[model samples]
Target: MEALEKSREHVIGLFRVVVGLLFACHGAATLFGVLGGPQGAKPDVAAWPGWWAAVVQLLGGALVLCGLATRAAALLCSGSMAYAYFVEHQPEALFPLQNGGEAAAMFCWSFLLIAALGPGRWTLPSLARLRRRPGTRPITRTSSTSSL
Candidate 1:
């Protein structure tokens, strides 16, 4: 069981890193038109949506890779993809694959895992700090009443 748990951690860590980098790549491409992105796309400026996408992709992806905000990033990006697929690209399924729902389903599942599991113990939250709190209760000893 312990070994299996450790394996799961390793795999999840890799997933965060890989997915984060890829998302960041997309964000960067969309925002700055860097590395030959869409021509004259004029990335949406309202709410700096493009920039936000870039930041979220770059920073969030990094956090996921480092297991810092794996769950948070996952949940956020998952929703983004959902909106894109259903709202924006709703006319048909992904470009290929017989108009199937494969990619959308995969995205949901991946992000769900992130939200459900959160960044594992290896994250930056400092577990030691979690163990100690200001309002901890004191232990009490019971015996014959006072005067024993």
Candidate 2:
């Protein structure tokens, strides 16, 4: 059981590393206009400006990938998706048929899971052993006048 747990932890830690890198890529795309916009995808409206939207998505992705603020990042991403869904995708309906917000939905779910389970053991946060400390109590000897 312990072995199983260790393997699971390592797997999740690796998962976070991959996720973080991916998020960084997406963030860079938005920040630097690699994919499309100078600020990534932006809803066409008088809504929030494209620059702020890009920052929100990019930052959330980074946090999720880092596992430093998993829940918070996940919530932000999820909320972004939800807002996008209603504001954009809902009018058109589901995906494939319209490519409607499905990708965003998946992103939401992935981050949500990450938020719940976290990056697992072997992560930088847990690897230091700083929180648990080194050892327990020490044994001491008593000086008695008895011979054995």
Candidate 3:
């Protein structure tokens, strides 16, 4: 229990990175037809919900991955996934098991969790702060001190 508690933040950070990476990959695949190509024909540029949804997924995922504006980005991602589930999948079936909405539901819940928990220690902003802290010098190849 003590070990788990101590590593909670690290676990959350790993979760956030993975979720963000997967979300970004999903968006990229949909938008660019890469990574085994889009589910169907790629949506036309500026197309309705499809294009917009992909945009949100890519941008929001990137933001969350970098832990920049994580709360807002995670919230947006969660909302988008919820919308995808309810509007796109729920209409076909009452539950995710039969609706092919498991991914949507999972992503929605995962992002919601991230939004509530916040970004953990590993983040771009945190790294920048560490670098800029007093008495800390920016690392360089020629620098004698390797610590930091």
Best by lDDT: 3
Instruction: Write model 3 residue lDDT over 1-148, tens digit each, in one string.
Output: 9999999999999999999999998899999888987777789999989999999988999999999999999999999999999999999999999999999999999999999999987899888887687987867776476678
Q: Estimated TM-score per prediction? A: 0.61, 0.64, 0.89
The pairs that clash in candidate 1 are none
Q: What stretches of model 1 exceed 4 Å from their correct place?
A: 1-5, 35-42, 47-55, 93-105, 121-148
* Order of candidate numbers by TM-score, starting with the best: 3, 2, 1
lDDT agreement with native, every candidate: 0.63, 0.64, 0.93
The per-residue C-alpha lDDT of model 1 at residue 131 equals 62
Lowest-sum lDDT 10-residue window in model 1: 96-105
Per-residue CA lDDT of model 1 for 103-148, tens digit only, reads 5556556766776876654555544557668698646777866674
The CA lDDT at 44 in model 1 is: 65
User: What global local distance difference test value does model 2 have?
Assistant: 0.64
Q: Which sections of candidate 3 miss by over 4 Å?
A: 136-148
> What is the RMSD of candidate 1?
9.6
For every model shown, the clashing-pair count is: 0, 1, 0
Q: lDDT ranking from best to worst?
A: 3, 2, 1
- Model 2 residue 37 CA deviation (Å) reads 5.7
Clashes of 3: 0
Q: Which wins on TM-score, candidate 2 or candidate 3? A: 3
By TM-score, how accurate is candidate 1? 0.61
